[model samples]
Target: MRNTLLVLLFMAVNTISYSQNQFTGIVKDAENGEPVFSANVYFPTLEKGDITGEDGRFEIGNLPAGNYKLVISSIGYTSYTTEINIPAEEFEILLTPSAIEMEEVIVSTPFHQLQSENVMKVERESISELNKNGAVTLSDGITQIAGVESVTTGTGIGKPVIRGLSSNRVLVYTQGIRLENQQYGEEHGLGISSMGIGSVEVIKGPASLLYGSDAIGGVLYLNPELYASSGETNGELRTDYFTNTRGYQSSLMAKTSGEKLKFLARGSIAAHSDYKTGNYERVTNTRFSEKDLKAGIGFQDQKYKADLRYNFNRSEIGIPEEIGIQSTRKLPLLPNQVIDNHVLSLDNKFYFKNSSLDFRVGYQFNDRKEFEEHHEHEEDHEEGEEHEEEHETHEEDEDHEHEHEEHEGPALEMHLETLNYNLKYNLPKIGNFEIITGVQGMYQTNDNFGEEILIPNAETFDFGIYTTAHYHISNWDFQGGLRFDHRDLQTEQTLSEGQLIEGIDRSFNSVNGAFGVKYKFGEKFTGRLNLASGFRAPNLSELTSYGTHHGANRFEIGNPDLDNEQNFQVDLALEYRNQHFEVFANAFRNSISNYIFINPTGEEIDGEAVFEYDQQNAMLYGGEAGIHIHPHPLDWLHLESSFQTVTGELENGGYLPLIPANSLTNTFRVELENIGRNLVSSYSFIRLRSVFDQNNPGSFETETPGYSLLSAGIGTGVKLDEFMLDLRLSGNNLLNESYISHLSRLKPDGIQNIGRNIMLSATISL
Candidate 1:
């Protein structure tokens, strides 16, 4: 890893002759041919972009000689996207004036098409937009999107659930590489921070054809922040304060871009005290603190481009049991977790006139430690004991050993390391057909370091190969793909004073495929149909665990004979849009064979309930529908409503565990182009969120009642001389509702979620 880092740094500093190719264009309004100033013109593939000048002219120099997708966008006007060849003649681009939101390129899927042109129905959200909606964390923000939910242990730890599946089922990608950080654990949160993230794209259904195993449920793709434009240097400072947790977050970012090299760095820190409930009672030991640093460097020439990104994150989070303490403490107490993660990724692209090759590699190291309250055992010695000298010597040795054991080491510790690589080749376009073939895989190893072990030391190896294609004909788009994956798992045998365990070696193979069609019905309606298959191999814990998992408060037993889980899903989506209104609906039904889950055995081990891994057939169905309205005459006023629901059931009977309740959300918003003399833009919004009752509980699970929450926020951008400042004030749970989420791990203890929270944030651009 050290050698690789040095090589990457050397490449970033080395320079070559610049290419003479340059692209220039002018952006104008379609209605009156008026120049559109300050419009963003970008090439997603090259990681290069330019802003239109006052005269609407933009120039991008030193571009590789190849075909690239060009996107031009500005506020209050429809975005323009098209395929353009480098070194082509200068041209004029016209954008239509519209009230609808501008479309962004979808990076999760192949072809990198806009959502409107994608065959798959993907949800995309920007970090800035999520923050404006009063989201406290990246996971909390994603719940605002339809068809998505989270299994939360607290505000600091959350596992994303897509369409009722979570844990090892959903795969997360960052910086163009797979993120492998012990995701099999439900208490593990998404380690990637939102500080340097530009946006997030979600693939809601089976994506095995694109990602491989573990993507049977879906995928979360996080795009990193873009580098500064050529010859530009920029800096930003952002800060936020929250009332409920007495939490504060701050970040500093700086970037500079040369003609051939670009570099960026960001540092962020956050700390929060125990959160309070609606009754103003603090949840003891729920405090958390985080520190993060992200950096990136990129170098490009005529034929090749390379980008290297690195992130290091450290977090200390407390585990709340019964809410005993009432003080606002920022540091976590015993029964807490300390985690450190390091992620490094390097992406390289080779451009060849009509085709391109992309190679990406990533390395991740995760160190997780859990500390539990310690108790000392007392031994009594009789006054008139025989062999007094021997007894004294034994007691002295025992005391020394006890002293060493009391040195404050973690009760449980694990180190996970992963190395993954991806290679894709874009074939030359044949008429209207475009195809891409890729190979993706990873090698991982997990080691135990502490006194307690939830899972034995194990090694995993994965290899996959896939091919996908896209074709455009008339008003219809067709896409299909096929993939094959193989995984190998091996564990070491261990023998203890009271227990004997045998090691096992297992191998699994799977073949998956996906097909989809998208059609445009005239100018206002669009429809899509998709069918896909996916699979996931059993994780280490599911195959070798034999002890208690303190994080979940249960003793678990693994099943080494578990089979691979395979699933098939069918999805349908429809959309209607016009000058005043936009509506969309998405539906999906999934069937799985050999679905794996943990079942209570009605047994106890050492005072803890025992659970064992089991497998059964299951089915899941869900849909999401939403509408946005901007009255023609009152474009500043907007009304939006959305509803999402999903149900999961075992083949024999009962419902699946951790399923999210049906939810509905409505928002009323008003936008002002200019609020005052210094305020250039402003917006305010109020939202009502409702969760319906969840009576369909799985085995050992109880029913949960529904609840409603009210929230509102206002934000504005202020212009001061040549600098820009953004300010926002938001409140969540304004009604102070005392409610518990169906997927909350703390719900069984009758603990309510965080109550009314007021947040104030500001960002200054220099």
Candidate 2:
């Protein structure tokens, strides 16, 4: 690993070249004069590049002293290309918006724009951000956003969690289309990758107002390559090699566009051997490898644009089980898992004189195969490796592995399909008003069950219609939405002590909505209020699942008679921003009626440990506050800080699992540019983060402790006439502080986190 880092660092310093003549200008909205940020300014053949800033200013620093064709493009805008000469001084250029006689453009302010009351945008480094495991995942990108967390099984598998919900509570939309798969498994991380993403936006609260169910926790939007104003093309090639895990990851993406059409394609592959925790102990018992592929085609003249996309992924992992004692230590034996998933989607958009429309339809299929056998497994408790001593002693005293039965795997198959339609109209005749409406339908079929306990093949169908309207009167923007859903669920579960008995039937219908208002306080601050309602039907797997999940080492059970859960939420946010500073504070409280819950009773039914699912009245509530500072004070330094806390409990005072409590993150950034005139250099940032102990009450499982983790990184980029390069070296847990995260099942009794590690990554544009 150390040698790999040295090599990457050497490459960073070796890739320097002479300069080229430069052309520079600022691009803004023709109507509003708002700067178009991060607009791609490119010369494709030369592989040269520049990006517009927050002020919409772009400058190609080194132009190889010549007349060159330049292309520029931005989303929701027209493309422009022309020939220009790079003299000594920067020149100002203006471009016009694409004209197709379409509706009033609703400009998406970078990342959540922070421009409008109805929409919130967050812009930051997603593709460039690395994870604790040293390799980046889309899931890692979401950690920076408030009200977001990951249900991680290991460094390789982290599922997004919104609000106080995970699993089906949150929805993922990539390129304006929904993604569905059987993600309940531990290794489902293989299902998606962040290869070519430009940015990620998270809607932190109830969003049934627009996206329908599953938005209960919120929504994650992963957008593709942002187009430049010119008619050229865009692309990137990034390769990351990690030392601690002894693996490599590579990604490549490309896109091309003309006046009427745009197309994009990307592929990625990551492979790693087992990684070690602190010391020389290998925490991961599996050797894992994953591959991802995605392609998209889009068509547009002026009034309409349609997109078709397909994604495929596959992974294989060794599921190691301890079967015997090797001198008082449990010995790991060969056991394995194989998983594969495929998704295909189509989305269409149309723009008229005063309205914009989007339609989405998709299907996803998955097949998982698993194998496991005799092993005595116990949780390590949400604490570090303090339990290793006990594990070693027990192995020496008892015959733990040879007595258990060999666990056989199952044949798993699932298919889910969704069809959706949405339209937003900016009613010019109705003054300042925008109305958004949509309807979505989904049908899913699955054959997932155990031989002893059969949950017959089942199918579910759901349809929903929703509408949202934004009305602005003076400084106040009032927004509200209403949604209605009809659901039909058929569960096939045979009840038989001997002969087969027919399965039962069930169904449900629900209504959800939200009302919100934002009051602008001058140009620097805004206060917003939202009152929302959300509902979730019991998922097929949640209702009919029955089996053993060896990853967590626990027998599982499910109930088919569970009812739907409904919730009411109230949230308030205050935001202030200006040229060099930004501050945001948010608060919310949610009350759930008929909350569905799973309980483990330390009791076993027959030979399998029986866990039951039931409904109860519960209350979930929490809030977060953030403050950022990027003052012009030094021109060479920047700092930012944020804090968040949350808590929840059952009606009977039982504590909810996995509630994040009081956390803090602080970051400092400094840079130096225009070095020796030919070079622009910068040192990005250093961050400190920590999480407090979880003491929210009822948890028979275990508890999590407060621990502090330190991380630091530095990077530099070089620009040549036709080539550019970037490099970064990062380290985490420098103190080797031992701690356990709440979501880690192994932290309760298995292996702890990897102690200390460093990584270096590089990107090259050809």
Candidate 3:
């Protein structure tokens, strides 16, 4: 009789476990009792999801038995979120209609939370939304967000500047890993493609508590395109054309997903000729081209999920000089760069009864080459003529000939390889408190293989450990984290211009922390206050460089005794939102110790101005404010306005260099849904931007005049039987404004920014 009881108990346990693996839910409109079809029901932590069918029913199976956060979202409705336990009764979700934009998940933070619930005020924008604003490139698109700007060399090269800091201060992440492409140089571009990117999240302040070194200023996190819904297959083809540069862009993407397996692939190519300025003069050697490919595969079961992704990109960018040539050539001329990059990453997650573990590993390889025009000197020819008689009788001349052949090739070539990993454990939630602990590290190497070496060959190793927690009580949320990091850098001595440059080995350590609080006032107001500290170790160029940077037209000298840069920043944000109106303001103050910068030494080397790296204490303060309005009855109309300002100064006396001028933007937009039988949606918009004069210039910089620009765009989506077509027409600098941006690298040469450019784009979905 005892044996019989044991068998019955085991059978009951198995039945319970099987029942807990599946869940069902139904979605309906809150106002009416009608089903809401195509609503997305997802469990983010579990990596499990399903879409509601026509009858508003969704069922997800093969889930581990645990308490999970359930989210139900649909267009034109407010998203619903709640905590659910396995084996619970069926859920009936009611969604309320809303005119405001839907909230998105913030992935850059340790805890993935909705934007409305996050302690930090992160800015997020979709790639499609940026493209609709007539952005010519990814770096250009980010400038549309307040408190963000770009240092542009020309139409082909740009670097992102957050607040008033740039270069190695800001960190960029893609494919779940930090991007390393020798970002210390001002002439280097972002080295990222816009195709296959879903959205971008910007952390406006110090994020070293989450991402260790090099995040003293901020971070830019890019999210890849998601897989298709389960049991669905989709494909798309897109094309774009620009008039100012005679540019062409084309891309293709396909994705398929099953219950346990998913796959996606995308390929894109872009080419452009020299861009014309407002005066109809084309800048010489400003053309550029790019090719990119992205692929990903994922698998998930009851307790584990794994995803693997790969990206390959190649770019050919021209180094713009004086306005000399007028040809509309697609290929870049001499004094250009060729860069190839490859990235691979693997992400894995394991689920337990009440907790989870995540492991991610990424590898990246970058190959860069620069080609410059080779000039022959008359003295060298005369010497060669004298040696011609001896060359015919000596075998050493053959070696000299081979050396000459090599010198005709690329002037600079460098290879960089990086490997990084992250392991995080999410502790089981205790009531309304959650915690996570993680370890992150990276190993990288840089090698030079050309005639010119901008930086000596070096290797670097990094390790960091951190823990973060979040607590919720009443209408308040609190978050804080602490991190410790260590780095070891080693370099090989080399010769530059017959000088023996000494090599060095060094190690650095740092400890950083962050704390933030969010409070809700009534139902329409929210406030956030955050304090964070960050640090950055000096990079290779700052420590070892001793060469002329042809791209920047300057000779650089490095300082090997530079110390680590540390900073502290305090940020405050206030937001008020309702059904028809929204307003937000963000303010921040940052103070830094050992702030590094470049200054002219009043010397010349190889016909280039000499500059040396130095450090001092600095301070920067900025604020951004924006407002959105949509009248009660005129919900289709939107009026938006925003203003951004920042100022930087050295503690000793002078203003900081490269600070963007204050700017204001105003936009008017109209949107319509389902205008006709074949028309799915349509939108039209016009925007005006004004930049205030920058009278307070750095000691070594010149002042810039103020300017204004106008832009307009129109777009529509059409349904044709089994396919959907999207079309857009946009124009930038519509009034042909002749002005130079304060951050333009070519401003000293009296070069005007691109103007009067029109773009047409089309996409077909199947």
Misplaced by over 4 Å in model 3 are: 1-20, 376-407
Candidate 1 on 193-268: residue-level lDDT in tens?
A: 7899999899999899999899999998999998988888999999999999999999999999898899999999
The Cα local distance difference test for each model comes to 0.87, 0.61, 0.88
Instruction: Give me the overall lDDT of model 1.
Output: 0.87
Candidate 1 collision pairs: none
Which ranges in model 1 have alpha carbons more than 4 Å from their true place?
Answer: 1-19, 376-407, 495-497, 674-677
Local accuracy of candidate 3 as per-residue lDDT tens digits, 612-721:
99999999998899999988888889999999999999999999999999999999999887689899999999999999999878877899999999999999999999
> Residue 561: error of model 3 in Å?
0.7
lDDT of 2 by residue, 92-194 (tens): 5455553111121112221111233343322233455444224345665577666777766545566777666777777777656566665554345536777
Per-residue lDDT of 520 in model 1: 100
The RMSD of every model to the true structure, in order and in angstroms, is 7.1, 11.9, 7.6
Query: Any runs in candidate 2 off by more than 4 Å, and if so which?
Result: 1-125, 129-135, 184-187, 227-230, 318-336, 374-429, 448-456, 495-502, 606-608, 671-681
